[model samples]
Every structure is written in C-alpha cells, then in structure tokens.
Target: MWIIFGILTLIMTLLNLYMYNAGKNYHIFMVLSLFLMALTLCDQYQMIASWSLAGDWSAIADVAPTLSMILWIFVIGSFVVNVIPLLLSYRKNR
Candidate 1:
C-alpha cells in the first residue's frame, strides 16, 4: 500500500506542478496533494520504525493506531477536490 501511495503521490505532485506552472489557479489542490504525499511518506517511516524495533513478524502487524487510514483519507479527499474543481470548470466552459 505504501509503495502504491508513494508512486501515485509522485505522479500527482508532478501533475500539480505542471498545473500550477500553467497558471490554472489550483493552488489549494496542489498544496493539499503535496501535504498528503508527505504524510504518506511519514507513515511509511513509522511502519519501518515499528518493524525495526519489534524485530518480530507478529508485533509488526499488531501496531495500533496506524496512520495509514488517515493518510488514505487525505489522499482521497485531495483527489475529490481536484476533480470537483475541474468538473465545475468544465461545466462552466460548456
């Protein structure tokens, strides 16, 4: 999951950069996506730390309050924000 998020985040970040450079006025979505991507990276770090300390397969899977879910929410929300604005723009242009 982390790897998947990481790759998606990279792609989105690049797209965001392009959009911003193109003067699309989509700063909020860009910033939100960037933040979520950073959060995903942090979650990956937490997982690594937990695994290293536990040194046991079972304990690695038992860590509570994992931040993965929250990160997912942020990712999905960012996507929604990006899509909604584009949709609104499309409707207006039509």
Candidate 2:
C-alpha cells in the first residue's frame, strides 16, 4: 500500500542524504528510488486498468492524475540531485 511505499521512500531519501553529505556515491539510492517509483506507478496503472475493465468509472475518476505526476517529479529530482555530484566527483578525480 501507499503507507509501505512512503516508509520505503523515506528510508531511501535518508540514505541518499547521508551519502550526499558524506560525499559518497549516492547514485545507487537514486536508482533505487527510480525503480521503486516505476514499480508503484505500474501497479497503480494496473489497478486502474482493472477498474476500467470492471466498469467502475468512478474509481478511475477518483484517481488523481497529480499523484503520478508528483511521483515522477520526485524520481526525476532525485536523479538530478544524485547525478550532478556523481559526475562532478568523477571528473574531479579524473
């Protein structure tokens, strides 16, 4: 459920922050966040598709499109935050 997703996301975010602050590679956690977000979106899409199959128009209507948009934003934001430092560090080391 969303509660589980929230907890996992929170843990990942904390790990990412710690790694970032320590100047360690945080790309792995960013990748994990992207994977998690994709999985959740796919699951949500499947659920919505099932609702349509069941002729439950109301269920589809109830799904806020903004929710998925928000997820996309967060995943993309994580990539931006993690990747810049990773690239910068790589270049500096080289």
Candidate 3:
C-alpha cells in the first residue's frame, strides 16, 4: 500500500512539474506535490526502520507519525483550496 501511494505521489509530482512548465498559476500545486513526495519518502523510511528494528519503535515514536500527520493535513487543505476555485469558476460559467 505504501509503495502504491508513493508511486501515485511520484506521478502527481511529475504532472505538477509538467503543468508548472507548460503555463502559469500552477506553482502552488507543484510546491505542494513536492512537499507531499518528501513526506512520503520520510514515512517510507520510518516504516522500514520500524520494521527492521522490531521492538525499537520508540526511537522514532516521538516525531515520525506526528510530523506525517501534520503534513497530510496540509496536503489535504491545499487540495481543497485548489479545488474550490475551479469549482466556483465552473459554477459561475454555468
């Protein structure tokens, strides 16, 4: 599941980069996508370490999950913000 998510985020980051270069006003999406990719990588690392060490999860317990959760919140918030403008514009046009 993590691998699948990582792949999906990787694709999103790539698409954002493409959109950013193709035109204007996509900088925020690109930046957020990059941030999400970084967070996903960090989460993957933490998961690997936790699995390898088995009973030593305490070492990363203080920070990893909390930071990941915070990043997820930001990612979701940004997605909502990005979608709202488009939805409003579509509604206005209709």
Which candidate gets the maximum TM-score versus the true structure? 2
* TM-score of model 3 vs. true structure: 0.43
User: What is residue 68's positional error in candidate 1, in angstroms?
Assistant: 19
In terms of lDDT, model 3 sits at 0.62
Task: Name model 2 segments beyond 4 Å from true.
Answer: 87-94
Per-residue lDDT of 1-94 in model 1, one digit per residue for the tens? 6666666766676676567557677666566666667777677777768787878656556543465575567667656755655676677789
For each candidate, what is the lDDT?
Answer: 0.65, 0.69, 0.62
Q: Give the candidates in order of lDDT, highest first.
A: 2, 1, 3
TM-score of 1: 0.45
lDDT at 84 for candidate 1? 59
Q: Give the Å error, residue 82, model 1.
A: 16
Tens-digit lDDT track for model 2 on 1-94?
Answer: 6546645665676677678779887877867765666666676677778899999987677675766677677667656755666677778889
Full ranking by TM-score: 2, 1, 3
TM-score-better candidate, 2 vs 3: 2
